[model samples]
Target: MLKVIYILLCILGTFLPYSQFLPFVLEHGFDIRLFFEQLFANRISGFFGMDVIISSLVLWVFVFWEGTRLKMQNLWVYIASNLLVGVSLGLPLFLLMRQFQLEQQTDTAIS
Candidate 1:
């Protein structure tokens, strides 16, 4: 049930953000300057932007530490997902993988 929810979240995480972002790319053709201009255009937007930046850094550190501790492979995949999308994709994805790994460990221990 938890895995199912995580999978659903992953689908949502990818779809929701890209749904908003793709149109921007189409309109601006990857205009980084304009992107930043609009992102920090107001206090609320700036707050969200700064929050995301801090969250991303924290996610990176968590991905490294916990992922390494669990011997999870392909840690870069989480970082790449984070870069390509955001925590929306990365967090749920990592949780899904972590759940799978934990399940595997449980099975191994039982066997």
Candidate 2:
């Protein structure tokens, strides 16, 4: 359940860039007025890069939380890896934790 929510969040995070780009693309497609309206209506789009950074940080926190919750053997390793990837990739880290949760769930179910 939580894993599913994380997966969905990851999917939504991946789509964020596209959502930000939509207004620009719409303007290029010659709907300038509508584009500006849509763009400003969602003021957050004006700070897409910042939004991505914040989202990445939030994702990293989620990863850390999950790692600590599961008490995995290499919890620090996972945390460090997620921190590095989160900073370097400038992308949300939710996918990594989501994958971990899915694997953990599967392993438990199998046992």
Candidate 3:
């Protein structure tokens, strides 16, 4: 049930943000460096951007360690999703998947 909630939230969150981003992408055409430059152009955005990036980096390291320890497949998929989408979607999505794996393991162990 909690996994379902995470999945739903991931879908909705990704959709809403990306929908708003579509027009911006059409105008800007996928320039990452330029995006970073503009993102840090202001003091406020700079602080927030740096905060998000550092947090994301830390999360990625932890995800890699734990995912490997748990032998969870598609770990790279989560990383790719993080890169392609955003942490808001990827983090919960990874948690959803991790929960699914745990549920399966528990069921199998019980059986």
Candidate 4:
């Protein structure tokens, strides 16, 4: 059930953001300058932009620290997810993997 929720979240995370972003890319063809211009064009947008930047940084730290503590392999996949989609995809994806790892550990211990 938890895994199912995480999977749903991963789908939402990717689809929701890209639903907005894909059209921008199609219209603008990856205009970095214009993107930044619009991103920080106002205080409200700037707030969200700064928040996401900080959130990404924090996610990296958590991924490195907790992921290594759990001995989770392919940690780069989480980072790549973050880079490609944002926290929406990255966080739920990590949690899904973490849950799997935890279940595996419990099974091993029980055995």
Candidate 5:
């Protein structure tokens, strides 16, 4: 059930942002320059973008530590999801995978 929720959130995170970006990209010819131009277009947007970037850096460190500590096989997948989607999806998706990993460890220990 929790996994399902995480997956749904991932879908939402991907589609909702893509829906906005796709149209813009199509209209503007997919220029990375323009994308950054708009990203830092104003003080508010610059702050938001910087916040996401800094937070993402912190997230990457945690993902690296926890992924190694837990021996998570799909750590790359989590990183890709964060890159392709957003932290809103990737963080919870990693958590969902972590939950499954913990459950497996518990089951094995119990057995």
Candidate 6:
């Protein structure tokens, strides 16, 4: 569940580019273009990028830790492992995790 939330947050963060056009962001004097340019330049942006990477890595490690805790049988742990892989591979893997969980629950109840 934590992994799912983290992946969802990453997807949510992608929409942040559009947030620059919002009145609140604009009111705060945020410059979208400059931000993107700096990101493209790969320079320090007050540790934002570093923090993102570090947090993502930590979340991924936690997912693995949780998996080991579960004896590799809990479906959620597998879903979480996939979520981490999805994050690493830059794929829409989280959505699949959600679908798998829904399907698994329904299947279990029917059995």
Local distance difference test scores for all models: 0.96, 0.56, 0.83, 0.96, 0.83, 0.51
Point out the higher-scoring one by TM-score: 2 or 3. Answer: 3
Instruction: Give per-residue CA lDDT, model 5, range 18-64, as digits (tens).
Output: 89878988899879899899999999999998997887777788888
Error of 5 at 26 (Å): 1.3
Ranking by TM-score: 4, 1, 5, 3, 2, 6
Residue pairs with backbone atoms closer than 3 Å in model 2 (clashes): none
Reference-based TM-score of each model: 0.98, 0.36, 0.88, 0.98, 0.88, 0.34
Mark the 10 consecutive residues where model 2 has the least summed lDDT. 83-92
Residue 45 in candidate 6, Cα distance off native in Å: 1.8
Pairs clashing in candidate 5? none
Better of 5 and 6 by TM-score: 5
lDDT of 1 by residue, 1-111 (tens): 999999999999999999999999999999999999999999999999999889999999999999999899999999999999999999999999999999998999999
Candidate 4, number of clashes: 0
By TM-score, the better pick of 1 and 2 is 1
Query: Candidate 1: where are CA atoms >4 Å away?
Result: none
Better of 3 and 4 by TM-score: 4
* lDDT, residue 8, candidate 6: 72
- Quote the positional error of residue 16 for candidate 2 in Å: 14
Worst 10 residues of 3 by lDDT: 16-25
Report the lDDT tens digits of candidate 4 across residue range 14-46.
Answer: 999999999999999999999899999999999
Span of ten consecutive residues with least summed lDDT in model 5: 81-90
Runs in model 2 deviating more than 4 A are: 1-46, 73-102
